[model samples]
Target: MSQKVERYYVPAQSPWPIVGAVALGMIAVGAGNYVASLPDGGGYSGYLLLAGIALLLYMLVGWFRNVIDESMSGLYSAQMDRSFKQGMAWFIFSEVMFFFAFFGALFYARMLAVPWLGGAGNNAMTHEVLWPTFEAVWPLVSTPGGTTTEAMGWGGLPLYNTIILVISSITLHVAHTSLEQDKRKPLTIWLGITILLGLAFLTLQVEEYIHAYREMGLMLSSGIYGNTFFLLTGFHGLHVTLGTIMLIVMFFRVAKGHFTPANHFGFQASSWYWHFVDVVWLCLFVFVYVL
Candidate 1:
């Protein structure tokens, strides 16, 4: 007799995706309106933004629960596992492309546009007609328009945050190793510590931002340098926040005896994401702060 091949399981239509789309739409509109209203006064947009975020969170929780239940029940096959892994790989690749665009902008400004504005490429007439006193410089402390601001140094809080994130990455890797080795206690402990470290990194990042605004005079409107600095770091911080949340969810799943030594794609995906975020931060620290 021939061995039987298991039929692929197809899930029922999910309403969560459409609900998520609606939630995201509301969030975008609400956030835009809320920020636009900030110059005047508060408005209903703020409330709408909060409601959208809450609803989105709820949807995530429920959707994840259903997926977890299905996985635990062995509904997902090896092919499904491969599909999930590939999906995560592509997602991370997309993120890499997103950051690549920002880094490209930074390079274009620093290496090309700024120099072009300073009379490079036989543009002497252009500079003389425009910013006659403009000097091309890395960190660009003063704009061609004569608006001056201090460049943020790489020491102090930024250095400390770097150390924290690097350590967290190591701890998370050790946790993954422990999971592979089936050492539950070490896995839990290391994973918990990793989460705490992520939280600490976020806290220090917020403090750094506050110091930048209040003490360093580094606002989003400071100049092109400031614009690139905040947008790059701010987006990285948001990704770290999301990665931390994913790790927290994995921590709970581990506590509940969910993943085994061989089957833990969820944990593995979260780890990959956390490491990607750490790598992005390292790049930011070098390009944005040190370089």
Candidate 2:
């Protein structure tokens, strides 16, 4: 008896990676300059940021189209499927580390740096010489430079957004279950609802930011509290936006009869990403907003 070995399909060389790198580079430079020019209004850097985002969208569409074509053409084998699973798993793990670093910074500031500055561990002289007026509060509303800002509470928009995201995750899981059962109508309806929920969350977050900056005086340049709050929430918002885009794409693909009950790794990958985003938001609500 002879055993059959599956041959893994290797994709041809592509230019999408380089394109994505260039796009990211542009976005970084643009965002840096835009932030630096803030409160004075962004100049050319804003345009550069938009251009980079456009290029990134183009790259995503093209790369996804290529992969979809290959998959639909029966070029993918079980080995390829396993490879994709591994790749997506590692990608999500990398995202976990990215958030870990941000959360670590928050913890260090709260647990160590703030206390040390306020004379917690026999550094009273240091505090006296530096800024004896410093209060060392968790949400340090007052800066060393005498700039004060109100803290954003977890009551209104933040709480609503949290509820929205939690519900979106449930809807997305229902959509995935529908896909697994080969029920296209329910899958489309549930996935569409998930996307709407994601958009609603983003909208509420934007409104919250507006209220913070305009009324609460919680600008990015406010102090350490503002810095951590914006950094964590801003990055999480970006992730939510990307996840929503992914879900939108999956919705269209489902409409085109792309995924099947047996094999739908693309849809599965998007679901994993959506769930990860939801989990991140829950953490943000707890650490950044509530506690």
TM-score to native of every candidate shown = 0.92, 0.98
lDDT measured at residue 50 in model 2 versus the true structure, 0 to 100: 92
lDDT of 1 at 174: 100
Q: Using TM-score as the measure, which candidate wins?
A: 2
Per-residue lDDT of model 1, residues 76-141, tens digit only = 988889889999999999999999999999999999998888888888677787877777788777
Task: Write the residue-wise lDDT of candidate 2 on 252-273 in tens digits.
Answer: 9999999899999999999999
| TM-score between model 1 and native | 0.92
Error in Å for residue 84 of model 1:
0.5
lDDT (Cα) of model 1: 0.90
User: Which candidate has the highest lDDT of all?
Assistant: 2
> Over 4 Å off in model 1, which ranges?
30-49, 143-146
